[model samples]
Target: MRVLGIDPGSRHTGYGVVDGHGNRLVHVTSGTIAVPGSLPFPERLGVIFARIDALIRQTAPHECAVEDVFMSRNAKSALILGQARGAAVVAGVQAGLPVFEYSALQIKQAVAGFGKADKEQVKQMVRTLLRVTGRLSSHAADALAVAVCHLHSRTSPLCRQVGEQR
Candidate 1:
C-alpha cells in the first residue's frame, strides 16, 4: 500500500509518502508546504487546500493518513490546526483516497515504541525504520511517522477486529 501522511500546521504543513510492502517500508517523498505568515488566515487555508489537492493528484497514493489535533492551551491555535487538518482531509477524500486519522500518541508509539516519545526520538526511529539518511525536517518526519502508524495498525489483528466492529 502506498500511503500519504500529513502533519498539518497553519504556517508549515508537512507531507510524506511511503510505500508499504509486507514488513518493509520505502520512503517515496517528503516535504513541507511552507505558507507565508503574511497571508491572511483564510488565504493560507486556501493555499493549503490547493497545494494538498495538487499533491494528491501528483502522488496518487492509495491511502491518506493524518495526525489528529492535539489538545492545546490556546483555543485559537487549536482551531487553526484543526482547520489545516480539515483541508488535508478534504483533499484526500476528493481524490478518492481513503483517509485515516491517528492521534499523536498513536503515531509516536508506532514509530518510537513509546506514547510519550519526544519528537527527536520519533524522528530517529522513523529514519531508522525507513532507512532514511541525511537531514530530515521534524514536520516531515512526523508525517512519515503517521504513515508508518497506519501501516502497522492496518496489519494488526486487534486493529482489524476493532475496525470491523465499527
Candidate 2:
C-alpha cells in the first residue's frame, strides 16, 4: 500500500510518501510546501490546499495519514495550525483517499518505540527505518514518521479487526 503523510503548518506543510510491501517500507518522495508569512492566512491555506490536491493527483496514494492537532500554549496558534491541517485533510478527501489521523504521541511511539520520545529520537528512527540519507528537514521527517506509523498500524492484528468492523 502507498500512503501519503502530511505534517501541516501554516508556514510549511511537509509531505512524504511511503510504499509498504510486506515488511518493507520504501520511500517514494518527501518535501515541504513552504509559504511565506507575507501572504494572508487564507491565501496560505489556499496554497496548501492546491498543492496537496496536485500532489494527490500526482502520487495517487491509496491513503493519507496526517498528524492530528496537539494542544498548544497559544490558542491562536493552535487554531491556525488546525486550519492548515483542515486544508490538507480536505485535499485528501477531495481526492477520494481514505484519511487516517495519528496523534503526536502515537506517531512517536510507532516510530521510536516510546510515546514520549523527543523530536531527535523520532527523526533518527524515521531515517533508520526508511533508510533515508542526510539532509532531511524536521518537518519532512515528521511527515515520513506519520506514514510509517500508519503502515505499522494497518498491519497490526488489532487494526485489521477494527477495520473489519468498519
Candidate 3:
C-alpha cells in the first residue's frame, strides 16, 4: 500500500509518501509545501489545496494520513491550523483517496515507542525507521512519522472496519 501523510500548517504544510506492506515501510518522497506569508490567508489556502491536489494525482496514494489538530494555547493559531487541515482534507476527498486522522501523540507513540517523545527523538526514530540520512525539518519528519504510524497501525480493527465498509 502507498500512503501520503500530511502535517498541515498555514505557512508550511509537510507531506511524505511511503510504500508499505504489512509492517514494513519504504520511503517514496518527503517534502514541504511552503505558502508565502505575504499572501492572503485565502490565497495561501488555495495554493495549498492546489499543490496537494496535484501531489495526490501524481503520487496516486492508496491512503492518506493526517495529523489531527493539536490543541494550542493560542486559539488563533489553532484556528489557522484547522483551516489548513480542511484544505488538505478537501484535496484528498477530491482525489478520492481514503483519509485517516491521527493525533500527534499517536504518531509519536507509534514511531518512537513513546507518546511523550521529544521532537528530536521522533525525528531520529523516523530517520532510522526509513533508513535515511541527513536532517529533515521537524514538520517534514513529523509528516513522515505519521505515514509510518499508519503503515504500522492500518491493520488494526479500526482501519479494517473502515476498509470493509468500502
Candidate 4:
C-alpha cells in the first residue's frame, strides 16, 4: 500500500510518501511545503491545501496518515496548528483516501520504540527503517514516522479507531 503522511504547520508543512507491503516499507518521497510568512494566514492555508491536493494527484497514495493536533501552552498557536491540520485532512478526504490520525507520541513510539524519543532519534530511526540515505528535515522525518505508525497500526484493531473518514 502506498501511504502519504503529513506533518502540518502554518509556515512549513511537511509530507512524505511510502510504499509498504507485509513487513517491508520503502520511502518514495519527502519534502516540506514552505508558506511564506509574509502571506496572510488564510492564504497560507490555501497554499497548504493546494500543495497537498497536488501531491495526492501526483503520488496517488492509497491512504493518508496525519499528525493530530496536540495541546500547546499557547492556545492561539494550537488553534492555528489545528487549522493547518484540517486543511491537510480535507485534501486527503477530497481525494477519496482514508485518513488516519496519529498523535506525536504514537508516531514516535512506533518509529523509535519510545514515546518520548528525541527528534534526532526519530530521524535516525526513520532513516534506518526506510533505508534512506539523504538528509531529512525534522518535519519530513516526523511525517515519515506518521506513515510508519499507520502501517504498523493498520492490521490491528486500533485501525478502526485511527482511521477517520469524512
Candidate 5:
C-alpha cells in the first residue's frame, strides 16, 4: 500500500510518501511545501491546497495520513493550524484516498516509542526506520513519522477491529 502523510502548517506544510507491505515499509519521497509568510493567509491556504492536490495526483497514494490539530497557547495560531489541516484533508478526500487522522502523541508513540519524544528523537527514529542517511528537515521527518504511524496502526489487530467496527 502506498500512503501519503501530511504535516500541515500555514508557512510550511510537509509531506511524505511511503510504500508498506505487512511489516515492511519503504520511503518514496518527502518534502516541504513552503509557502511564503509574506503572502496573505488565504493565499497561503490556496497554495497549500494546490500543492497538496498536485502531490496526490503525482504520487497516487492509496491512502493518506494526517496529523491532527493540537491545542496551542495562542488561539489564533491554533485556528490557522486547523485551517491548514482542513485544506490538506480536503485534498486527500478529493483524491479519493482513505484519509486517517492521528494525534501528535499517537505519531510520536508509533515512531519513537514515547509520546513525549522530542523532534530530534523522532527524526532519528524516522531515519533509522527508513534507512535514510541524508539530512531531513524536522517537518519532513514528522510527516514521514505520520506515514509510519499509519502503516503500524493499519497492521495492528486492534486497529483493524476498530476500523471494521466503524
Candidate 6:
C-alpha cells in the first residue's frame, strides 16, 4: 500500500510518500511546500493547498498519514498549524485517499523505539528504514515516519485499540 505523509506548518508543509508491503517500507518522494514569508496569511494557505493537491495527484497514494495537532504554548502558532493541517486533509480527500492520523508520541515510538526521541533520531530512523539517500528535511522525514507508524499499526493487531476496529 502507498501512503502519503504530511507534516503541516503554516510556513512550510512537509510531505513524503512511502510504499509498504506487509511490514516493509519504501520511500517514493519527500519534500516541503514552502510559502514565501512576505506573502499574506491567506496567500500562504493557498500556496500550501495547491502544493499539497499537486503532490497527491503526482504520487497517487492510497492513503494519507497526518500528524495530529498538539496543544502549543503559543495560541497563534497552534491555530496556524491547525489551518495547514486542515488543508492537508482536504488535499488527501480531494485526491480520493483515506486519511489516517497519529499523535507525535505514537510516531516517535514507532519510528525510534522511544516516545521522547529527538528530531535527529527520528530522521535517522526514517532514512535507515526507507533506505533513502537523497536529502530530506527533518520535517519531511518526520512525516514519513508518521506514515510508517500507520503501516506498522495496520499490520499488527497489538497496535490496535478496542475502538479502532470500527
- Best-fitting candidate, measured by TM-score? 4
Q: Model 6, residue 86: what's the lDDT? A: 86
Evaluate all candidate structures by whole-model CA lDDT and list the values in order. Answer: 0.88, 0.90, 0.88, 0.91, 0.89, 0.85
Which residue pairs collide in model 4, if any? none
Give candidate 1's whole-model lDDT.
Answer: 0.88
Write one digit per residue (lDDT tens) for candidate 2, span 73-161: 99999999999999999999889888888889889999999999999999899899999996888999999999999999975643421
lDDT of 3 by residue, 1-166 (tens): 9999999999999999989976678888888999999999999999999999999988989999998888999999999999999899889988988888888888999999999999999999989999877768878898999899888888775443112352
Those runs of model 1 whose alpha carbons end farther than 4 Å from true positions after fitting are: 155-166
- Give the lDDT of residue 166 in candidate 4: 38
For model 4, give the 10-residue run with minimal summed lDDT. Answer: 157-166
Q: How well does candidate 3 score on lDDT at residue 81?
A: 99
Decide which is better by TM-score, 5 or 6. 5
**lDDT tens digits by residue: candidate 1, 1-166:** 9999999999999999999999999999898999999999999989989998998888889999898888899999999999989888888888888888888888888889999999999999999999999889999999999889999897565332111243
**Between prediction 2 and prediction 3, which has the larger lDDT?**
2
**Residues forming the 10-long window of minimal summed lDDT in candidate 3:** 157-166
Model 6 lDDT tens row, 8-31: 888888898999987778999998
**Per-prediction TM-score, please?**
0.93, 0.92, 0.92, 0.95, 0.93, 0.91
User: Which residue pairs overlap in candidate 2's backbone?
Assistant: none
Q: Where does model 4 exceed 4 Å of error? A: 160-166
10 residues in a row with least lDDT, candidate 2 = 157-166
User: What is every candidate's alpha-carbon RMSD to the true fold?
Assistant: 2.6, 2.9, 2.9, 2.0, 2.7, 2.9
TM-score of 2: 0.92
Q: What is candidate 1's TM-score against the reference?
A: 0.93
Q: Supply every candidate's count of residue pairs whose N, Cα or C atoms clash at under 3 angstroms.
A: 0, 0, 0, 0, 0, 0
- Tell me model 5's lDDT, rounded to 2 decimals: 0.89
